[model samples]
Target chain A: MSVASQDTTIRTGRVTRALIYLTLLLFALFYLMPLFVMVVNSLKPLHEITSGNMMALPEVWTIEPWRKAWSEAQIGVQATGLKPYFWNSIKMVVPAVFLSTMLGALNGYVLTKWRFRGDTILFGLMLFACFIPFQIVLIPMARVLGIFGLAGTTWGLVLVHLVYGIGFTTLYFRNYYAAFPTELVRAAQIDGAGFFQIFWRILLPSSGPIIVVSVIWQFTNIWNDFLFGASFADFSSQPMTVALNNLVQSSHGVKEYNVHFAAAILAALPTLLVYIVAGRYFVRGLMAGSVKG
Target chain B: MGFLDIDNTTKSYGPVEVLHEIDITVEEGEFLVLVGPSGCGKSTLLNMIAGLEEITSGEIRIKDQVMNGVHPSKRNIAMVFQSYALYPNMTVGQNITFGLEMHGVPKAERDKAMNDVAQLLQIEQLLDRKPGQLSGGQRQRVAMGRALVRNPDVFLFDEPLSNLDAKLRVDMRTEIKKLHHNLGTTIVYVTHDQIEAMTLSTRIAVMNGGYVQQLGTPKEIYDTPSNLFVATFMGSPSMNLIPVKLRVDGEAVVAETESSEGDTLSLSVPNPSARLKSYNGQTVTMGVRPEALTDAEGADHRSTHIEKVLNKVTVTEPAGSDTFVTTTIGGAECVARMRADTEATPEEVTEFAFNMEKAVFFDPKSEDRIV
Candidate 1:
């Protein structure tokens, strides 16, 4: 090639790369706009948030709204903090995530390795559970929980989240384990390892990436869920998301936009923290089935 | 009774039976190889022996103990899989000792066994590496180490070397042979590669279409295959099969075939079996190994009958030491192994010698040897 043509090619390459970066920057800004608004409004005084620009930075950055949102925000008839509700969410989510993830791992192992005659059909039905909308299950779930005397309890919410979240977690683990070599399981059996032994020793240790994906997914789902939390949680056992909704929609003498924004950010912190801590594994888990190691 | 006996064993999936009534008796410390093409039920038989698959009707006995309805772990067998099947998460040392750990062996004893096996397989340097970190050959060694540390009654190999590259496969093949010699454990190995079966087996059971076509020592199977399938499948540049009409001459039986140029060529059969008398005036298949057909100077001098024929060579493939010269006999392709220096060129007429002493005749209708 001539030098001039080579120069042109290099110039075009630079232009294309700059164009790609510019497009990505635009998307980044588009997605981050709501979080930016929430942070900016949460720091501003109530009058500044209500009367001034939503995009403008707070001239007087004070953490008073955050404190009030945490301890003094009025949620429904109660004027107490979102603190108790946050604890409720944690109490419900920890066990729900733990139990659901364990169940999903076992389900994935059995479905892939020790599959029975109708296992494919059973897995298909479990997969179909992931697509069902939450609205369809609310009334029936409420009646079932009521029958079990758990209608308004935190354990009821935990059970609800566990049941609903299992489908997605199982799907994640099942797809990941399907690509795993069955020879390992066979070798384990020949080595005198039984079912649980093979799973615990040979399979579970290699399940790091998928477990992270499932945990993050279930934590996010159970933490941010408001429908079940609102419908099932009593006032004393209301989750953070339900309390956040109540705080935002509750009418008072004047609107507390700063408190509402601060509450929303506070409610979102745990899931965001989970993603930030182990985001690489989440990507690896997503690409597990498509790319074999 | 042999150490491991599979008597009238059959395998079926619902309505379709894949393995017919298989009767194999493997003596203690014998290296028996089951070889066949894909879908020939060799691997299924190996699984049945390992107690991984349920026996359909017959009994599998190991050391005079019945093996039906037993779990694979209880059967005391270790299998090296084609994929190596190393635990991806465990270090090589841990993988080797996992079987011992499962059987509740003491840690000191397990370590001693692991060290011994690692040394035996020359994988001591790879003890700390995970399976993913090791190379293909290293992972295969670790797999063997895992199986060896168990010290099971029988070692089952399911095409274990099939995953390695050509050069590594030969090296591992030799290593496995040496290991078998040193350990002398009874082994039931399955493979589709006939060369592997011939090189490693003390006895070979060649299968086709769910039947054991022939079972014998490597030399016997190579010299006199029971049927046409075993004859064609057991050798490289496989045995050249020519359709020839049999005729009883004054004192000998002769096979009459045609050259590539449609010229008649007659070869006298040496020491004709009584069965050939009945086959006279009918067409039969003459099975001749490529080594049995050579250039005139390369013909075996000890053979009682040698016939020289000139045929047009269709192709000449020189593989280092031997040149495979292809020509047409009875309108079918035949290969002759000649010395590399032979002047056999494609599309040129070349003089070749056929050593009739080692040739076998088969009934074309039954596809079985007419012995």
Candidate 2:
């Protein structure tokens, strides 16, 4: 309200604006630095890459390594390479993401809203699944899949991903739906919305951020899984993650560092794209269930 | 015939009984309010009528049809919850029409119903917005609109305005009363607010501890409460209760309180009823409201001549319109409503007058009204 205060307020506002821009610029560089290093390393020859100064920009850039990674690295469908492996990853991860998220939403809706005999016990089991070490069950799961004739097939990895993904997905949705008003469910019941109808019409449409979080979590988990894919998938049906590991592990005498980096980038791109697209909803879902009216 | 009848309804969750032998009949156009404090089984009773909660033992009939075990939607009753419960993702229009849409109402008819309700509630501008975008009053209107669009046989509201701000609560309270007046539909409303119960109901059922303490017209319940709980619960700045022994005069019963200075002042009860005959020479509680006590010399002639009762005003609170004087009498503090002109300070002895006609008596043993 005073002239001196007005001058100080304007000066402080200017400084705050500059600070915000500086913070945003630093954030951008933090996210971009790794991708920039990967791109530069993929373009350089082997000698320059191993020169121990990994941070420097390439003196000479060439597309030959990209071409070699595509052709000699054997990442194409035409020659049983990374191309078929990528398609195999998609085939397994898509169904796993879809089925796991659907089942998680269903499980969460029932655990929080419905009062059956053993619902609390079922919720305890779901929470228990989240804490148990996956390595302990790996052999048992492998044997079960083998008995079902699902081992060495895309369905095998899909089933495995679903089994692991459902625990976290259901936890995410159960907490999110807990903050919802119980009266909404009761109102729907009074309005003739039976179990599934209440889920689809009343609960699902309101579950925007939670659904995004479930999809992103399941997709990333299934896409990046090396142990399950390598253990269950055979040579013809293996995902790109297994193929990338084989290329790195099976090389003899000389290591193709450029091809390895490119393959690693390929395996990671799907998950990175998903995070970029739905990161806001994932964070929003984390904050959704902490408050109630 | 009654629109809805509840016959000897009892509810319990295992060994914890919530409601005991609740019998109520709702006429076709009555606005009945079930009023009580929290944990008094009002909401549980409302849920039973709506078929959302199972009645432990009872028969509920709506329009001559048994409603026990009926699905909530099949019972033809719509409830507006205290939380509003508007679907957060749906527009107000969609929320109002959700029940209708579920019952297979055509889109055209649904649209018309939505328009009519929006117009009725004066919320036409908010129809396209979700519940999160609206104010508390607007969301409350949308909730009411949802129930209104159903055109069901009965309406149940469970403390629907308790969540709003005080000013908004009063505004919506009038709006709900007007809606009930216009609809001529059977409505069973629940609230802990005695003011809302007093102003809005055709009849009120006061409950406490799984039992109906009293059920009658609002005026009847206010003038003659059935028990001590009803007397204290129905009034703001509640009635003052004083323990005293009754002495029999020639043709009347006189209540005598032991004075602090070792003396006794006997106040005569003019019309002694038969209930007072058994209570003579026995300890009982005499209830007097604040408004019934005043300065002995005050201009209100009706209260001036009852009998001179002297007590020390211990605390004084002047709330602009009236002054509340707290005084100790017979080892209990009794609050009296005095005019602002009375010059009474703390711990000062003052002569206060009482209107014995308005005083109620309750048996101390049972806590029930003597008559």
Candidate 3:
């Protein structure tokens, strides 16, 4: 069946359709080429990657590079794998994503539903954090982390990401909850639902789309963050990104390209997997807040 | 003490006063409706009663207890919001029982209450459905069920049927009136609709510009409005106010106005009060309802005095049940209701009967009734 139906306003000719699909395919292939190179070379021996074409398939297929990449990354006198750093990233991300999203939902509910004087000004101040450059806050964040003695711990990274993630998460949730009927909150109030109960039962239950948007956003940002990980974390607790950087920097004179490729993909895998699973919801969630009732 | 007493209550947003010293006592089983045009502080007063809004000054009492700092749920009040405001996540049964559940009612008790309210609202089959899945009318029932399940001391309805279609609104209006009749619950209903006020309210507080213009039974508000605003705001086509000079003769008082054809039409005033002496030779407003000024045959049979006058019809609008004949009387546009097959055409001279017994006069300066 033709997609350009009788009611479609902008009808395209067959030639135009062919040209459009060709352009889309070219862009898709262009974007996928790096991922393609990494996967193909990571399967081959290191010599084959250095001497062979990036576009060529691997002839000497071995899983040794994947295994070494998974368990062997040199960081500060220890021959530790990416595994501990991977755990560090997970430890940082889970708490940061969950806490930031929950706190954001609460902030949104209070700002929109239980309004007080100067609330708009307060909201504007909260939003100012979202636009503040990350580099500007690093010194102060480091000082605060040092004062709290969380300077090089996984929790320190969690705190940093949580503090930064709150602004964007609150923006998403506040705008989403603004469209939520205040009448519902008032009705729940009359129904004797207290502040926390109203948030847990009424507003949060209907906050599925915005929550997905927040979780994906916070997860990707906290997982892939390099500067925060490098600055705040110690050698023992550095996240995957920092460990990957160290591994590449300390490649022992001769380059181990296959292990590097596999390590790079390993560092990037979680976020990519997250996008594949929830990519549609991210797009849908963006639209839902702006348009859906 | 009354069931609900709003004594000297006022609400102001910062410096701007929205409700001014509103004092009204609602007895048990009284369906008191606060009706007005938009932004008239009706809903604000309702909210104040519900403790959803703080009373800027003075006191509100429910069951003889001051409710100034009380939380809404503690006030033993339930509200049906304009949007229905059902918890979208909950089923109809849960929606109805959420209040009871929050009050720490047991599971069995909550279930029983929900079932009872569902049957009462005739929404038993909709128990498992979410609010979004229900139709607007069904959602309205669920909202009412939520309110009714609480069985609070007072039921506050903030334009609950405003979202329904016209047909459903009328049906719901009847159902609400029936429910009030059966339950005899003290209700505070707020609406912009005068028809709903007339149909459902045992007593209505006609409000405008943050003031209650009149508070009385529907018949009293309709027949003897206390001011010009109440006269115009309470009726569908609204009461006609014509500028007329009062003539005080020996024993007869007459409302003096000139007809469209340059003929002086003198209509007699009924029950001429001692106040008529003060309004003599003064241009006052003659407030008469459209139904009071009709074709002679359609005039009220019990009306003691039906004064006849000739006026040129400006327009004849043929409504299905009746015709509204518009004409210039005393240099002001006035509507006269007549039979559906009203022969009065535009630009034609028509003889109209004015029910002098139903006539009221307002001092045009202060705009208050002069009786």
lDDT of each: 0.92, 0.85, 0.91
lDDT per residue as tens, model 2, B1-371: 47899889999999988999999988998989999999999999999998888989988999989999999999889999999888887899999999998999999999999999899999999989989899998889999999999998999999999999999999999988898889888899999999999999999999999899999999888877888999999987788888889988668899988654446878787687888877879989988878777776653675433676777778999988778899877777788888887888887777888878778888988998988
Q: Write down the C-alpha DockQ for each prediction.
A: 0.85, 0.70, 0.87
Worst ten-residue run, lDDT, model 1 chain A? Answer: A4-13
Which ranges of candidate 2 are over 4 A from the true structure? A1-37, A45-56, A75-80, A252-254, A289-293, B258-263, B296-305, B340-345
lDDT of 2 at A117: 89
Worst 10 residues of 1 chain B by lDDT: B270-279
Cα error, residue A175 of model 1, in Å, equals 1.8
Residue B291 in candidate 1, Cα distance off native in Å: 0.2
Decreasing TM-score order of the candidates: 3, 1, 2
- What range of 10 consecutive residues in model 2 chain B has the weakest lDDT sum? B296-305
Name the TM-score of candidate 2: 0.90
Interface RMSD of 1: 0.6
lDDT of 2 by residue, A266-285 (tens): 77889989999999877777
lDDT for position B240 in model 3: 92
Sort all candidates by DockQ, best to worst.
3, 1, 2
